[model samples]
Target: MKDSPSRPLYLAPYYIWIALFVIAPIALIFYFSFLDLTGAFTLENYQNFFSSVYLRMTLSSFWYAFLITLITILIAYPTAYWLTKTKHKQLWLLLIIIPSWINLLLKAYAFIGIFGLYGPANKLLQALGAGPLQILFTDFSFIFVSVYIFIPFMVLPIFNSLDKINPALIDASRDLGASSFTTFRRIIFPLAINGVKSGVQAVFIPALSLFVITRLIAGNKVITLGTAIEQQFLVTQNWGMGSTIAVFLILFMIIIMMLTGQKEKGGLYNGKTK
Candidate 1:
């Protein structure tokens, strides 16, 4: 396993690419996050980010993204669990992944087709005398589209985790006087939590960063940290504040990963590949 000259040369390009592209940008972000509008070093932006208004906005953003993450897990868990028991697992997986192949903007816009004021769902409801329904430009629409867009993230992890469970465990639980719900709660759910953690991170982080979909569907009235960052950069030209928020978001992500990763690493899962 010793690295030869040829091996070092072969991997040099990837190392250089990582250093230039990834490391360089991160370094720049770190630098910018500490600067002020006048090119002077300052902590004013960070202080403002913790003020009541900005803090409330950031908390609201986390809360909404959290709601989206919870909803995605609740919906995807059952779907993924059922899919694992299906006869055509590959086909189901393909179907699940098909939406991801479409452009994210296109997929977000496609929801407009089904949930807009004159969209099919509303039209059908009106035709049935259920009256017109408001579906777009609201938190509800935001949650719905976010869930749809991120479902695959939640599902894939759960599916992978569920696939590792020995079915015989369930049979044994049943024979030992446990009901289906009890066994799942006691055995299946605990074991699958790692996957759940991974899936939730995948969904929540990106969902928190979503600005385009929020702008389009939430009428730009609802402002999350994502929207705040975008407005700071694009609208207000306040790169200092934008970078501060971005840095905060990155810190928040790291904190979440550390907490979840600790739980995962300390768990009973012994790296047994299924």
Candidate 2:
């Protein structure tokens, strides 16, 4: 095998894009992480990151991301499984995904009205003889909105994985006296685990870094790593500390991807066997 002279030409745009957008930004962040407010090079930023305040923020961020991801998975798996059995599934799936095309800010604002004190949600609660509860600007509101936003992302991957399953295997399992639950547990779930992994990867990473939903929905009651980063860079004008947080965030993102990403040569059905 020899090199193709045209290969470099073909890959030039991709490499250039990565260098400019991905590599360059990461390099800049890494460089800035060691500098202080006065542009003096120091490790103080990293030192602050290890302190109790930051450690608590990091734990809280993880806890919130975990809850959002878990709720998304619980809802999405059932929705996707149902979609797989539908006649016009693609249409329904498209409907589910269309909301994601709308601007996130717009959606957040829409929820603000929906969950307002005198809004439909509270009105319904009042109709049921229950007093209007404060729904907006609460952890419940934040997690609910976040889960709603991420459901489509989670469903699409699981839907795709479920769709790829061979129909005959399911039929054989049923014919061989296996119950629906057993067949699903033994066959369908195993084959679809990769999609679950992909869905988790898609939902968890963004959930970890979400600031807008926290601001609009949670009303500063919940603060994640993203909120801290925004406060550092924009509010306090501390780019060094912000970049240090970003560098660590990037590291966490990498570690998660490594854990959830599938290998090319393995899985229950990559068409290869040992």
On a 0 to 1 TM-score scale, where does candidate 2 land against the true structure? 0.91
Q: Write the per-residue lDDT of candidate 2 for residues 1-274, one digit (tens) a residue.
A: 2666556566789999999999999899999999999999999999999999999999999999999999999999999999989999999989988887778899999999999999999999999999999999999999999998888888888888999999999999999999999999999999999889888888888888889999999999999888889989999999999999999898998898899888842233321110
**Which is the leading candidate under lDDT?**
2
lDDT of 1 by residue, 23-100 (tens): 997788778878888889998888998899999998889999899999999999999899999999979977997776
Q: What is the model-wide C-alpha lDDT for candidate 1?
A: 0.83
lDDT of each: 0.83, 0.89
Give each model's clash number.
0, 0
The all-Cα superposition gives candidate 2 an RMSD in Å to the true structure of 4.8
Candidate 2: C-alpha lDDT: 0.89
Error of 2 at 135 (Å): 1.0
